[model samples]
Target chain A: MAPLLEARSLCKAFGAVTAADNISVAVAEREVVGIIGANGAGKTTFVNMVTGYLKPDTGSISYQGRDITRLGPRATARTGICRSFQIPQTFARFTVLDNMLVALNVARKRDLFFWRPAHDAELDAVAQGLLAGLGISGHRDQIAGTLPQGVRKILDIAMAMVSAPKVILLDEPTSGISTDEKHAAMDTVMNALGERGVTILFVEHDMEIVERYAGRVIAFYDGRILADGAPAQVLSDADVRRYVVGGELHRRQPRKGVA
Target chain B: MSVLTDRNVLVLLAAIPLLIAAGPIMPDWVRFFLQVSLASGLAVLGVVVQMRAGLVSFGQGLYYCLGAYAAGMTGHFVGVTDVFALLGLGIVVAAGVAVVLGFLMSRYREIFFAMLSLALSMILYGLLVKAEVLGSTDGFNLPKATFLGLAPTEQALRFAVYALTCAVTLLAAIFLYRYLKSPMGRIGEAIAQNEIRVEYLGSSARTVVHITYVLAAALSGAGGALAALANGHVDPEMANWTTSGQFVFVALLSGTGNVAAPLIGNFLLEMIRVYAVAWSPYTWQLILGATMLLVILFLPGGLWSLVERRKAGG
Candidate 1:
């Protein structure tokens, strides 16, 4: 079968700076992938291009065997590709459960135009079930703005998941989370997502998370993929180590032959 | 207790009968004040509807004026004084304009949207001021409105108009509440909160704004028609910037807390205007400005927040 989502020779630029250059990626069904990169390395640009938040300067993207490169974010989401943000985006004034309900309510376009309340009991049940699965049901009544960082992160992912998209791009799933809660948050998210058999691509700076949860890892440097393989292999690749994982030039081991 | 909640549908529905029952004992001025208030409230309600989607227009008077003229023209040219027909024509005309303008309006946000709306209303004002046949700036008197074929006499006319206004206002409030509770309506608030998130949820923010624009225009149209009928006259002033500003002021004062808020806010505002103008006359606007300032500073949520605070506190 064709890959769940495929981007071909994608290139995007802002003024003289290249956000994504000659980038191509394929996400297969049911695969859990982790992307590692430094700031401004084009990880988010890749996700943005795929989810149709930003159009690629040159390239084609296909989903489920149909061309989706020209689609907008709303159209792409309807085609089963959704994305969550680095900073959680939610309706701050609404209750946490209401946030989920918004996702659920907007997902069903046919039943949306009626005089009946948007807070239908059926959708309410589904929202509650989703919240419970993410271990955030206890905060359902709390205003989303006041939610703890970990809970808000889960809520963000949960919103992207509510549509049951076949592929989800999560930008820094554990970015704002406390160090102690990182694994727990990942465990809860991965386990909940696993039950639904979702294919997830998450960006993270934490090496341990990439090694532990990712079935495949792709390392990005500048605007290109530096390494793509199993976590152990890619994380140890000399170029990935030097350009991505290794923070500074002083931290790198000089090449023996060249020296 | 949830004053901002749509659950107040029943309370809104109940208010109709309660007001109708009280109409008999009311003085002529009170009845006149209420009908005018109810009509203006509908126009302000239009403003609030758009506010839900994080959109505001300084040109809402464009539709209000259009509604009145559309209805006014029907009587002037078509000789149709049946109230329902006039109101229906008003809605159709306003909605038609909104449909075309909404496409353009939907593309804009914040200040651009406000200025564009103001510009459109002023265009109408200028046209109305110049058109000689439509009575120019002086405007023209409307024929007495009749229900179906039955025309109420002078003695019963006040109550008749008052009752009609109540029924029409109630229906508008209820339908608007339902829209607010609907998914599309909720989408407006979501769009207000985060337009990007709304798009990722698989709905168009532009479409929501367009629908809301049309919906608001229709309500303002109905209000203008009813007001024209009640006042027995229509004027270019209906589309003035000050008039549109008044609608915005009433919308902010009412808060988006409940469907009933606009009507209550308009009524209270009319009462305040009556007292202020009676006492201060030339400085009445200063008094209204101070009132609005106080509302902004202390009751930022509008008058409805008082109800919300009491419920939250209790």
Candidate 2:
């Protein structure tokens, strides 16, 4: 089958630092792929380039057999490639339900300028249902900014799911979440995306999350892919063990049973 | 049917008779003050819309003055005395200008947007002062405004203009209310919060801002035409940065609490300024400045927060 997304020989440099260096990867349909790397390992750089947030100095990106290398974030999103930020991006002052409703409008491709009242019985019902599914309906009327950090991240994921995109890119889905709460958060995100059969390429720092959720794992080291395979194989790769996963894996592995 | 059922439309309907009745009984100066207040309130309404999207157009007076000049010039030269024609032309001219300027303005945000807007309004101010036929700095009177085909006597004309001002402002309010409640309006709030996220949600911040700019300009234009009719004059000072700043001031005074807030805020501001100038002519600005300071310190959401707080409490 044709890859859902493909990037070839992606290279990017920011002044003195190399962010993505001759990197290439492809994601299959409905594949739950976890990408791991140390800071500045070019995981985000690659994601940015693919999402049209940053232009890669060299290479091409294609989605579903069409070239999308130069499409901007808005156009890329319209093409069924959606993303959520590392830090939850939300309309902080708007009600949680309002956030979902706006996303729904975009997803449905409704004429945004339609002059009727924004909320009708049917749309509100759908929005409420979506929020309930994300376990955030109780806070429907609350401003998103005031929501707890973990809930905010979940809300961001909820917004991303509104479009039911062909592929979703999540940057650090559990970054600011507490260690105790990360598993629950990831569980909610994974289950929601899984139910929709979304192809996901998420950048994660947690090895356990990468192992437990990812069907395939791609490990990055200093702007290059060090290993790409099943989680156990890549996590145990000699170079990955030496440079990336080493002692941190040993310390966190014992706690893996919680998920 | 939906337009008729809208709450804003209902409010406008209810207000028309009350305003018309009040016009006849109110003292002449009081009637004049109300007319100017309602007209200026419409301009502030434009500011309020841009504010909701997290944009501050310090050059809104550019459109306001353009609307006035458009109306005045057309009435003076074309012999178009029909107030409706002039008002419609003003909106078209202003919106046309906005379509061009919004391309540049929408590309900016925060202080850059504010400064660029201010610069544009000032450029209009400079040009208007230099244009001799348009009355230059001294400005010119608008030919007597006529409604439909009948030119009412002076006292009757005051009431007509006052009634017209109320009706047009209310209509603008109703449309603006719908715009504020539309999906695009919600996206405006989202753009204010996070532009990147708005893009990821499949909307362009620039596109939303552009539409909003044009809408705001059209509104300011309408307000300017109404004001020109009410005051019987159009001056270069109408586009001056100070006039634009006052619109911003009214926006701050109104808050983004709701669409009606700016309109009410404009009325209260005009009332206060009138009283201040009468009671303490030389130091009236000092009083106005102090009141603004107090509102910023004590009621950051502007005067509308009082109503919002009451609703929340209830």
Candidate 3:
């Protein structure tokens, strides 16, 4: 079967820096993949290019077997490819439920012109259900800006999920979350997506998370994919260990009981 | 509780009859000033619409002048004095201008957007000042507006225009209330908050901004046409920078959260300006400035916040 999303020979550079260079990736439907890389290693660039936030210098991106390389972020999102930001991007002054409602409106392609209200019983019920599923219903009425970072992160993900995209690129889903709360945040997010049978490619620096949640791993180094395979195989690859995961392995190895 | 909130319909319905009745008991000057306030309020409401999308259009007077000029020209050139026809033509003309300019204006944001709008309005002001055929700076008077086919006497005309203004203003408020509650309107607020997130939600921020710019221009144009009809004059001053600034001031004075805020704020501002000029004509500007400062400091959400707070509390 064709992959849910595919990138072919993607290359992008910023002046002297190559943000993504000759990197290719495919995300299959219902697959949970983790991407690991150091800062400036092109992990984000790859995701950006795929989600149409940034255009690649060369190569093509296809979603559901259709070319989407030139599409803008909005167009790409409409094609069932959505993304959450590294920093939570939400309507800060609005309540959490309002944010979800806006997402649902765009997702459903509702009529925006004329006298229809933004809220209804059906929309409220759906928003509340999504919030409850993510364990953040308590914060639904609160202003999104005032929520704790972990809750904000979860809310951002939940807003993206409201569209039920075929593939979602989450940029550091647990970055701002407290270390203790990181795993719980991921558990809520992964379980929610899993229940929907949605494919996800999430970037993370936390090796433990990659090991625990990711069935497939893609290690990036110097704008190239160093290794791509099952978590155990890719984590032990010599080049990945030397270039990307070297120092962090010793600290995280004991937690995962990996040799 | 309908798809569009209808709670404010009763308030709107009540305001119309009360305003219509006030025309007889109110002094002539008071009634006249109220008509002007309602007309100007429509323009301020336009500014508020753009503000919801995080845009501050410093050139909204362009449309205001366009509306007035359009109405004025219809009476002077086309010799059509029917108030509704004049207003309709004005709206169509302003919307046409917006369609062309919105394409360019929508690409900008922040200071660039504000300045570009200002530049466009100033351009119109300069052109109006130079156009000898259009009465230039001195401007020409408008013929007494007719209602359908009846041309009332001067006293009756004032009451006619006043009643019409009240009806139009009430209808605009109701229409705007529905729009503010609409999904499109909420998305505009979302654009103001986080445009990037709006894109990821599968809606183009630029498209939303463009639509808002055109909608606002239409409203401003209609307001300008009404003002022209009420004042019985059309002048280049209608499109001046100071006029645009006043519209902005009114938008700030009234929070964008509620559709009626700008209308109420504009009326209050007119009353305050009248009293200030009467009480201390030389320092009226100082009084206006002071009031603005106090409102900003104490009511960051403008006068509407008071209403919101009361509703929340009660």
C-alpha lDDT of all candidate models, in order: 0.88, 0.88, 0.90
* Candidate 1 CAPRI level: medium
Provide the TM-score for each candidate, comma-separated. 0.95, 0.96, 0.96
Q: Which stretches of model 2 miss by more than 4 angstroms?
A: A253-259, B1-9
lDDT of 2 by residue, B6-61 (tens): 76678767887888888888998988888888888888988988988999989999
Alpha carbon lDDT at A160, candidate 3 = 92
| Error in Å for residue B221 of model 2 | 0.4
What lDDT is reached at residue A106 by model 3?
87
Alpha carbon lDDT at A218, candidate 2 = 91
Residue pair clashes in candidate 2: none
lDDT of 1 by residue, B219-278 (tens): 999889888888889999999999999999888887988878889999999999899999
Best by DockQ: 3
Report the C-alpha displacement of residue B268, candidate 3, in angstroms: 2.0
lDDT of 2 by residue, A1-259 (tens): 9999999998899998988888899999999999998888889988899888999889899999999999999899899998888889998988898888888877777536748666777888988887888787899999999999888988998898888798999999998899998998788778878888899999998888889999999988888899999999999999998888787788865575676
Per-residue lDDT of candidate 3, residues A1-259 (tens digit):
8898899999999998998889988888999999999998999999889888899999999988999999989999999989988999999999999999999988988626647778989999999999999999999899999999999999999999999888988999999889999999999999999999999999999998899999999999999889999999999999988888888897654665546
Which is superior by TM-score, 1 or 2?
2
Residue B30 lDDT, candidate 1, scale 0-100: 86
Model 3 Cα RMSD, 1 decimal: 2.2
Chain B, TM-score, each prediction?
Answer: 0.95, 0.96, 0.96
* C-alpha root-mean-square deviation, each candidate: 3.5, 2.5, 2.2
